[model samples]
Target: MQNSTRKRQKEELNYLRDKVQSLEKELETKRHQLMASKGEDKENKAVRVQLRGSRARAMRWQRIAKHQLVEKQRAEMQNLQLKESLMDQIKLARSLQKLLKKNASKKVEGTEAAQLQARLEFGNYCSAASEDSLYESLLRDMDAVYAEVDTVCARHPVMQNMEEGSDVSSLLEGETDALSLEATNSKVVPFGMEETCAAVWRCLSKDHVKLADGTYHSVASSPDCIRAKAITTLRVNTTTARMQMRFAMKKYVEPGRVVITLESASESEGPRDLLHGLKMMQRAWVVIRPVPFEPEDNEFDGDLPSEETIIQLCMRLTPSVSATVLDIPGQRAGAITELLLAAVHRNLGWLFQTVENILMEHDFGATLL
Candidate 1:
């Protein structure tokens, strides 16, 4: 019994040792697992920090982009305002320059009229003397006046039709007849020059008409032959048969036309009734367009010359009467025609000089041209 007891105790002691070894192995495995879990936790913390930094960088860039876009828009708006301001200044300057030029022209015209009046008085004195020398002197003075008139009329660049050796009277005769016959419609009166000669004036009727501003009145000798008595700031009476009209100027529009567009026809007409034999004046407008010079007639300076650069100045008289009434080229029409011709004759040189000066002085003029 003692031997059996000892063998059993030995077996129990071996089993106890095996149990302890198994427990030691399990504890080592648990230690290794805890160490690995701690390392994973540290790695997770670093990943979270890196993600925060990246987000901050992205947010910074987004703010910068937004700021830049705002600044860009502000600069664009400022630039646009500056451009508009510059354009306004340019227009104002141009208008001021034109006003100054017009004033100067008026002064020059007044001086010229005085001199012409003096010369006429002198001529009359010479003719009244009835002596050979006096008569000769008067004749010479009259010739000089004619020469002056001719010289003035001949100098226009637009007078290309006259240079073709055609007489001005002949050119006007047929056109004038047509104008006289068709007084109801509007017309285009062309002033053409051939080469370096005189301008050929031709009046031809057309359909389209622009308008002129300001109220005007007319006194006619007869309804059949209407005559202009009073124009704006200019009046002519029976006592003074002298026809002196001025202050007409052409404002050029682009594409070879100068347009003077007045208010609508209804607004331009005067009162219907007048004392004596007179008719109320109606609307009027003037148009000047460049007609191309014929190739044969053009004076070339290495540039293409068309009649359009040469010109046609037209005056359209819009009477209040309709197709039912009588219409013919009248004295009023003649007066307007004379006024335009004379005004241009006097002012063309001045106009050209002013334009040239403006072109030289300002970049705007060059750019516009």
Candidate 2:
């Protein structure tokens, strides 16, 4: 009986061992599954991080694009505003000219009637239409007109007499030499900056001269003395095609000042565009200096010396619009230069007369007429 009891106990122990083994295997399987789940979670986290990074980059680029677009639009709007203001100024100036002409026959200066007329004129000019169709028409026909002028000049020997007697080139060379000498002297006189500027302005502003072409000319002197400035403008072909040209001048009546310059350029809508559409042309201006002046009899105003001035006259031709596009097709450069020079010569007499009248009023002791 004892042997049978012992055998039964052994059998029970074996069954218990098998049960423990099965539990160990089940734990191992669970451990493997947990490890695999942890790996998948890590991969998902990494993918989320990559998506976040891409979204951030896209947003950054979008912001940069938006900023550039806003800046471009702002610049374009500013340009439009500037153009509008310029148009308004031009209209007002034209009206003022007309009013002055109407009152030319009577004594209007410093009078109540003159002041009233000015007020009326200002109002009219301010209300004038901004459309520049009249000006545009003139610009369109510049080429034809230029050609006709050239033909007429060739036919008439107007400059022929001057060419035969004293050629322009020799005269220009001599003047250039004199100007160089005047520029070097240091112990020179100084013109009262304020007085000189005022005088120049008055000379330009008060005169009205009618030209042969039926266009009127007027010079307006700037009131600002520190910046002595004057503008001489010509109005022509108003009925057919309104056109204008301005010669702007700046003067500083101080010693040791050299190198005065004057510039003229073709307005893009006018002669510039007429020459070539793909490329526009421009004109350059020459420098004009005041003829140097010195007081007679070795006079000195205390520490200040008398004023000195130098005068120079030159004409220039260059591309108006494009620096590189200077070639005028079908016309040699020489021929074009000659044509322009002749055009200027034709109007030279009128210019001299205008300057003479202004100088006589100021008693500058010089005359161009």
Candidate 3:
């Protein structure tokens, strides 16, 4: 009985030892699986962190691009506003010229009428001079405006073409049409006085003394010498195309015939001569044609001259006729003012249209991108 009991105890101990060994093997397998799963989780976390960093970089670049775009747009808007202001000034000058013409026209039979006419004429001259000065000021303003535009355009690199996942060059390749237009329209002052004088002389009638060097020595002892000088000087710095044609077409005529003649003289020639001529003409016109002129019965016949005919007449004539028929200073002033204002309007329209087309092209490109 004692031996049987000892055998049973030995069997039980062996069975317990086997069970413990099995549990240990199972625990080891579970630990290996858990370690593998933890390694995989860690790898996934690392990948997720890298993805988050890439997304942040992309977002940062996008914000920078958006800021640049906004700044560019704001600058364009400011330029447009400045251009509009210049247009407004031109319009105001036209209005003032018209008022002066009307005031000068009422027949001055009595002292009161004469005094009123004189006062109105004086006011007209002052206003016209003021307008002219303003126009000259705009020339300076235009340079500054164009410079600003160039600076902005240079700083902000416009996207000519965009691509996805391509290595974009730091300095994008792009081109602009602004330079083409500027090159074509750039004002060049005539090099020689003889060339300028000849151009002016050809526009005047044969009866009108042909001037040498833009200064006509009056053989005809008429008070109209000053008047003639004013008219000649006004047209002196006209564009070669316009000068060749002589008379301003409906398209070219400005209000009050205030032709802003631009001469491109270098510092060597000195601005003195050109400025002196301009001052003399301005003074003469202001003094002589203080009021706007009225159209005479003979001036506008049933057989109205066509634009081409008028242009030819101006070219063929000894001296170009001032648009205003008024013998009085004020009336001529008013008429010329109307003619010049029309020119300003035409030029502004042209400039605006060109700029708008460029912007539209950019917008289209952006849409494609």
TM values, all candidates: 0.20, 0.28, 0.20
**Per-residue lDDT of model 1, residues 345-366, tens digit only:** 2222223233233334443554
Of the pair 1 and 2, which is ahead by lDDT? 2
Q: Report the lDDT tens digits of candidate 3 across residue range 1-369.
A: 223323333433343344335435554554565466558657855754565457688688667757865775575554454444344434434333333333334333453333334434333432334433433432343333323332332332221111111010111111210000010011112112222222322322123433211222211222111111111222222211111111111111233221112211100111222221111011000000012223563385766332100001000001111112212221111222222322233232343333334444554777899
Report the number of the highest-TM-score candidate: 2
Q: What does candidate 2 score on TM?
A: 0.28
Model 3 TM-score is 0.20
The segments of candidate 1 whose C-alpha lies over 4 angstroms from its true place after superposition are 1-231, 238-308, 318-369
CA lDDT, candidate 1, residue 52 = 44
Error of 3 at 176 (Å): 51
| Lowest lDDT block of 10, candidate 2 | 178-187
> Candidate 3, 343: how far from true, in Å?
9.8
**lDDT value, candidate 2, whole model:** 0.32
